[model samples]
Target: MNYTLHQLHIFVKITQTKSITKASEELHLTQPAVSIQLKNFQDQFEIPLTEVIGRQLYVTDFGREIAIAAEKILAEVHAINYKTQAYKGQLSGKLKLSVVSTGKYVIPYFLSDFLKKHQSIELILDVTNKTKVIESMEKNEVDFAFVSVLPEKLQVEGIELMPNKLYLIGSEKIDNNLNESPNSILEELPIIYREEGSGTRYTMEKFISLHQLNVKKKMELTSNEAVKQAVVAGLGYSIMPLIGIKNELLNGELVIIPVKGFPLSSIWNLIWLKNKGFSPVATAFLAHVKQEKTKIINEKFGWYLDYIAK
Candidate 1:
């Protein structure tokens, strides 16, 4: 009948993940510690809150209700903390964010200034594929998420930060040929694909489908860096976001092959669940993004902006 809010927080995490092991990892606690806490929590109540069935954690109906209550309590606690900090004209809290993999290139520019302004704030950033990012958003796991493609199914509020332009990139060896015959580049050079579930891969697929172009598949890489490396080695050409290849293009390590329909445009958005409570940190970040987006983009991605506009 009596348990610590700490234990309830752990219980909520366990219920969300359906695994004590995962909950432990997320909570940055060892398995034994998490287990001890869970046992101590259950000892407080006469009924078992969760049962281990088939090597998996299953929350009882009572456990679900307890988790819901814990969520509300934790949210209220966070709001109170945020309000206190805001009233003091200070920004101090952990900013939890999940970003799509490619956003690794873009989010830092936005975060750097914010961090400089509020040195007291801590950041926890998770870089993952769009699917996992969306799952985190739906579960209310992060304060905000940065992504180019927004999920149609999730109820979220967001503002577009900047245009995400995808370009056909290849080695300099084919520069002359690519310039002469842009369409033939697909037939001549094998196309390197990003692995499944990538937002980049999804956009490439859409572009391919729209053009009805049959591209030669040579290799599929799991990361944007791997794909860029493969393309630089002259293994194949890849359709990649310009943001990811800025340094390479600037240093002439990779060449952007001009194509008639290329530089496919998408928008990067800073998004959060519409129903989730907005903390002071989250609100500040949202306002910062909107207010400084143009300046940030112009500074960090001016070349991309110029290229896409051409």
Candidate 2:
């Protein structure tokens, strides 16, 4: 019944990664050393913990239970360690955050000052599609998540940061004035769309449905950059956030199509699970964002503000 925390940690990592080699790599231990520890751990329990099949490691049912218990123990240990540092008035830890793809353009700008101010904090930012970001958030894989569309079912604590404005963009070579009406554009122009599960695509669909607009979708692209490029090549038009294409808009490479009920607006939000506790670093970043969002947006996103105003 006596097992070291180090042994338990290695066991948990092995179970999660399903590879002793990977666990060793992550733990910065030699492969043979990890194998010895794992063997010793199994001997203490006198229970087969893992089975090898097709050259891949798989944890048994008993191993799964032990792994879950080990994870909880490790989490408590980590909390104690963090509390010790906090008591010493030291704020030093890694902050893990995930954001929707479009957030890459906006989140960094908001985080820059905070990162510079808190030199002790290490930031791990995962920029991915909306679906993956939401999945990560729901699984509590990240400390914070930035999204334009809020998940209705998750019990979350969130703050609205800024407006995300979506506009129909086309190449400057085309006459944007001609397709001011949805019906005219529906019949005459081809529309480029983002891939499924995109926040932009979701918002665009809602807008289309609300207005009873049926447009011809010419292509479905995986990324905002791809959609923008397709539109710039005169292949079709796309609805994208203004934040992502400020430079193109300013340079006149793309023109916003003046369509009715245009510039579909949504809110940017920072969220975390309601029951999850926030570390000091997370709390600090939350405060920084809450205080600086408006000022930063007005300063860095002045073009968007001005455009929306007009």
Candidate 3:
């Protein structure tokens, strides 16, 4: 019943992706290499870990159970490696963060300096949607979650990092008629949207409903980038975080529609459960944010301050 850590890691990835080919690509191994390892690992156990049904791969019930255990083992191994680094007097551990898709632009700026200072600290930043980010926080899978809007159901403590301003943006090729009333523009143009569970979608819907603006929903995309691309391609307009579209705006690919009661704002917050305990790395990161948020914003987001001033 002896298995190497490599086998456990490969098996865990297989269970996650449910495809040997996908697992190989993720792990940077050849398909034959992954297959050989999978066969070797499977040979060590009597019960089947994975099964193939037609062309699709599926993890069996036992495989799911084993994957959970394998994840735990892998986590411990990571902890051990980090602990070894700590013994050398470096503040080292895994700093796991789940950030909403648009937050990818924001969080990395906040992290850049902190990571440079602490070279041994391992950063696992999961850039995902709001629903998945909240799910990770609920499952205690991350040290922190970066979001513009806080979840009503999760009682969490957070530090505000910066302002997240959302604007109704359209392709620059579209008519820039500032004379039109907000409601008239909304009613006339089709609107693209982030999928239902996105924070941007929530804020957009709230703004629409609060203003009671009659609008047409043209399409629903899952990510901020996708929505931005759609808007840039003149598919439709969308309420998007200003941070996510800076380059496009600068290059004249996209333009913000100046609507009354527009640029809906929220604070980008790094949040954790109210009662969650932090590891040394997480604690250091929190402290770093508290001390450097203002400086980071001033350096990285001065344009936003200028935009707000106007």
Candidate 4:
């Protein structure tokens, strides 16, 4: 459709979300408003943009070309915004960031301190699952990502951010039943697992495989929060990043197992597309990460730093 940059943005967002309803919610627009815009666009175009089939909306092949063009056009707009602001000697733009589910356990804390220090710069965070995190980064929807056990195939250049340990955690409901600590529960406890593509799940499974265990699973969960809740409900035990349970463990809402083959740790990565250029704000954020990396770790998790302390 022959449309302005703003309409192209709405069009691209709707295409990505695949539902007018979802796109409306994300854009803070009324569903009818999006509908009206789509109608207006169709009237101006040489061909139809979307077709409805069985309660689902599909962009036509012709519409796909328009969507792709819109994406590139929006990206150029964002690029110009970056250039315009950088010309003004200000790192004052929103840094759109996406992080995997587990990464939130620690990122918010770090990001808060960084944002407080850089008051003019904004951090727009999109906390999502691992697969979405990688896809969003690859699509240039996000400026930076902190992910765990990221696939090596991602066309992104990543730096090792930090190493994180996994632990067996369960709800406080099982605290009394825990005959031993999580580190010691690997022998016979039924374990709640993350879904198949989960990096955390893969890492945990690899640890069990390394120890040569039978690899029995109790249940599979999709979210870390759900796993925590399930363990709290005594539905089953689950292995999660140490940071995920730190607060709960301290609050006595969940307990760590003293199982023998635990403390399964893996490296966390800070990744960005190798060919993508960073905005001034993104560049500054990365610089902060590099400069304060050590002190941040020392203050954030003294227990983790103990590994290096020794």
Per-candidate local distance difference test: 0.86, 0.86, 0.89, 0.77
Candidate 1 wrong stretches, greater than 4 Å: 91-99, 115-160, 170-172, 179-181, 195-198, 219-226, 229-236, 246-261, 267-286, 302-310
Per-residue lDDT value at 303 in model 4: 74
Q: How many residue pairs clash (N, CA or C atoms closer than 3 angstroms) in each of the candidate models, in the order given?
A: 1, 0, 0, 15
Range of the 10 consecutive residues with the lowest summed lDDT in candidate 1: 173-182
lDDT of 2 by residue, 1-310 (tens): 7889999999999998999899999899999999999998998887789999999999999999999999999889877876776677877677999999999988898889998877667688998888988899889889999999998788888889888999878886445464366766655778898889889999999988877877788999999999988887888888899888888888887988777777889999989999898877988888998899889988988887887888
lDDT of 1 by residue, 129-172 (tens): 88889999898989999888889898998888888889888887
Q: Write the per-residue lDDT of candidate 3 for residues 77-175, one digit (tens) a residue.
A: 988988888888888988999999988888899899999999998899998888999999999999999998898998999998888888888996455
lDDT of 2: 0.86
- Estimate candidate 3's alpha-carbon lDDT, on a 0 to 1 scale: 0.89
Residue 114, model 4: lDDT of 73
Evaluated at residue 154, the lDDT of candidate 3 is: 89
| lDDT (10s digit) by residue, model 4, range 31-150 | 999888888777888788889999898988999998998899888877687667667775567888888888887677567777886666757898877777877887789888888876
Which residue pairs clash in candidate 2? none
Cα lDDT for residue 184, candidate 4: 42
Model 3: lowest-lDDT 10 consecutive positions: 172-181
lDDT of 2 at 162: 81
